[model samples]
Target: MNIEVNSQNLKFLECFASDTRIKIIELLNERPMNIKDLAESLGFSSAIVTKHVQKLEEAFIITTESVPSTRGRQKICHLTLESATLQFRAKKQDDQNRYAVSIPIGQYSAYDVKPTCGLASDTKIIGMVDDPRYFSDPEHVKACHLWFGSGFIEYRIPNYLVGKQSVRSLSISLEICSEAPHYNENWPSDLTFYINDTCLGAWTCPGDFGAVKGVYTPSWWKLGTQHGLLKQITVDSEGSYIDGIRISDRTVQDLAIHYGDDIRFRISAPETAAHSGGLSMFGKQFGNYDQDIQVYVAY
Candidate 1:
C-alpha cells in the first residue's frame, strides 16, 4: 500500500534515520523510557538526548507518557511506528514510465501462523495440511472455513520495496466468506482486520447471498450449506474495501501504515460467538483459486 509522504512524514523519517536517534528508538522499542534513563544507556548528556528526542516527538515519530519517577514526574518516550521502510525517489533514466508490480506473498520465505492453517500458490500448497490425511478429506480442510468462536489467520509480508523512493500507495486484496451452512444476510459476524499488529478496521458480514456462489464451491455442497458466501476485503487510505469497492470511509492514516522490513497481516474472531450463525472462512479449501490473498503496492 502507498502513502503520500508530505513534509511531516519526510521530517519524521529523516529524524529517525540518524544513528543517535535510531539508537534511541532501539532503546525505546522494548519499553518507553525517560530522557535520563535514555541518556544513561547511550552515554550521552541528558540535554543532548532531550534535544534529539524532541525532534522525533515533534514529528510524531515518538510519543511521551507522563509517569511517576523516583526523582519526581518524568515523560517517557516511545516509538510510534511498529516498522518502517526508507523510500527514496526513483533515479532518472532515458525512459520515463510508471510500472505496476505484483508480488505474491508465497515468494517470501519468512511467515508464521497459529493453531491450524495453510498457504498455497497456483503451483502447489505449502506449510501444514499438504498431506493426503487432511487434503483427502473435503470436510476436514475447506479452502476457506469460518467458525462461530474466535479464530485467526496471519501472513508475513517482507519489506519488498525497501530503499525505494516515493511510494504512492499500498493496497491489499483478499477473498473472504462465511464458513457456516446456509445464507442469511441478517446474521452479523464480528470480523476483525489487522495489519502489522495495528487494527485496520472491523466488519460484520451480513447474511449470506446465495445468488453469488464462490467459484470453487461445489454444487453438491448445496446452496449455503458448507460456505455461506464470499466477498473481497480491500483497504487503503480512502477506506476499507470489499469486492474492489469502498465499504468504509476509514482511510489508511487511520490504520497508521508504516514502511518496514517485515509487515504482518492478521484477521480473527473472538470466542464470544456461541454459534457460526452461517459464517465461514474459505482460505485454502473449496475455492477455485489457490492463494486467496493478494497485496498490491503503487510507487
Candidate 2:
C-alpha cells in the first residue's frame, strides 16, 4: 500500500493498470499463493493467471519463488510494493541544477564515543582498537573507513541552496551496513540519517557485509567480512528516497537546511530502534563504490 506516487517513471506504474493484476496483488497481499491457486480464487484460467503473474513479477510489484509440488514445482508469488506516491517533476528550468561535495569518512566534525568503535584506512587500523582518542588523531583524517556498535558521526558542510527560490533536494551517499564483532551476514541494523536536525529516514542494512573479498577491498585485508553496500539516498521537497526508491514523507523543507548554515549530516543507530544492529561505514578506498561520503544538491 505504501508507494511513491510520482509523475515520473510512468512505465513503472503499468502493471497496476490492469484489473487482473489488481486482483493478483490483493490475493498476494493476503498471503503468498501460487498461480494455480490465484487463478482458482480469481476465477481465471491458469494460463491467464500465469501471464499476469509474469508481468507483475517483471514490474517488481510481486516476487516469485518456485517450491516443490506434485508436478515438480509450483511458483509462489508475493506482493513487494506496499504503496507509492507521485514524483511531480525534475529540477525546474530556471532552478540551479546540481551541486555536490565529497567528505572523507573520518572527517566528522563531532562524534559521540562508544565501544567497539575504530577507524581504519584501506591498508590498516589508525591506532589501537576501540580507542576514541584515535577518532580525533591526525591520522584519523587519512582513514577511509570506520565502524561502531552505536553513537553518531556528524559532519559539517556548506549548504548549496541558500537564498534560492526553487525547490531543493539533498542527498548523501555512503557505503554502510550493520556491525558485528566480526562478520555476520544475518545482522540487521536500522541506521537513521539526519540533515541539520530533521530526521530524514532509516535504512535497515541487512548484515555486517563481510565474508568475501569486496570488489575494492585491499589485497592485504583478510576474507570472511565483505564491504558495505553502496547506497545513494535522496531527500527532496517531496520525501526521502534510497537508491531512487522513496522511503518516507519527510521533505526538503522539513530538513530546514539553509544555504548559509554549516549544514550537518549525522548517522547513528538509536537505542529505541527496533534493531540495535550497530554500524559499519566504508570509505572510497575500501568499499565497492570507491567513493567518499558524497553530498548532492539539486533543484
Candidate 3:
C-alpha cells in the first residue's frame, strides 16, 4: 500500500532521535516492561524515565498501559511500530527518477525455527536438519534451518530512499524456496504472507520445486531437488501477487500499509485450515542469490 509521510510523521520520528529516547526504544524491543523495571534497568530515576516516556507516548512512538503490581499501579510502555517506511519529500529537480528500498533477509534479528528448519545465504550454511542446538548463527547463510509453527522470520524495510519524487505505482519482490527433504507435486504447503498486519495474500506452493533450476541455485545442489519460488507482489488495480501471478484483487487501501505506524512483513499460518501440511521456506538457499524484499516506487 502507498503511504505518504507528512509533517506529523516527521515530527514523530524526531521525538525519538534523542539518545535517551533511543535507548528506551532498544530496551522495549525485547518485550513490554513496566516503568519501574525500565527505570531500574536503565539506572535512571523513575521521574526522568516517566518524562521521556510521556514525550514518546505523545508522539505515538510508544503506548503505555496501567497494570497492577506488588508496589501498586505500574505503567508499562511498549513500542507500537513493527517497521517504518520513511519517505522524505523530494526536491523539485529530482522528481523524475524512481527510487527503491531493498531489505535483505539476512538483516532480520529474530530468525526462528520450530518443527524443522535451516537458512543459507551467499556466504555460509546455517541450521542443519540434524543439528538442533544451532541458534546463534550468523547472517551469511546460503540456506536457513527452519521448522513449522515457529512462525516466520520477519524483516524490516525502512524506506531509505524513494528518490526525488512520489510514484504512480510500487512493487515488492522476494525469492523463496522450499527446504523439504522430499519433493512431491501435491504436498499442499501454504505460506501466508502479510504487510503491516494486513493479509496481502496466501500462496500454496506446488510440492515439486525441483523441476526447474533456481536462478541462483548452487551447482552442487541437485537439480529438481528444490527449485525456488520467486514471488512478486505488485500494488495496482489488480492487487497483490505471487510469483508474478495475481492471487487477490484486494485494493491497496485494504492492505493498510499507508495508515499504520509501521509497515510489517509477516508470514505465518493460521490454526484452522483445510489442508494440514507443513512449510519449509528457504530464504537464500542457493548460489549468489539474496532473498531480498524490495520496494520499487515508480514515479
- Say which prediction, candidate 2 or candidate 3, comes out ahead on lDDT: 2
**How does residue 113 of candidate 1 score in lDDT?**
25
Instruction: Name the regions of candidate 2 deviating beyond 4 angstroms.
Output: 1-96, 162-167
Candidate 3 lDDT tens digits, 21-57: 8889999887778887889888999999998898888
Better of 1 and 2 by lDDT: 2
- Give candidate 2's TM-score: 0.67
Predicted structure 3: clash tally: 22
Residue 196 in model 1: shift from native, Å?
0.5
For each candidate in the order shown, give its overall lDDT on alpha carbons: 0.52, 0.76, 0.56
Please name the candidate that would achieve the greatest lDDT relative to the true structure: 2
Off by over 4 Å in 1: 1-148, 164-167, 181-186, 208-214, 219-232, 237-260, 273-279, 283-291
Q: Candidate 1's residue-wise lDDT over 179-276, tens digit each?
A: 33345545566667676666656666654434333445554444352333334455555767654445567655565445665556676654454433
Q: Which has the better lDDT: candidate 1, or candidate 3?
A: 3
Instruction: Please give, for residues 122-230, the per-residue lDDT of candidate 2 as tens digits.
Output: 7888887688778888888888778887888898976656566443778777888888777897889899988887887888988886654455667776534557776
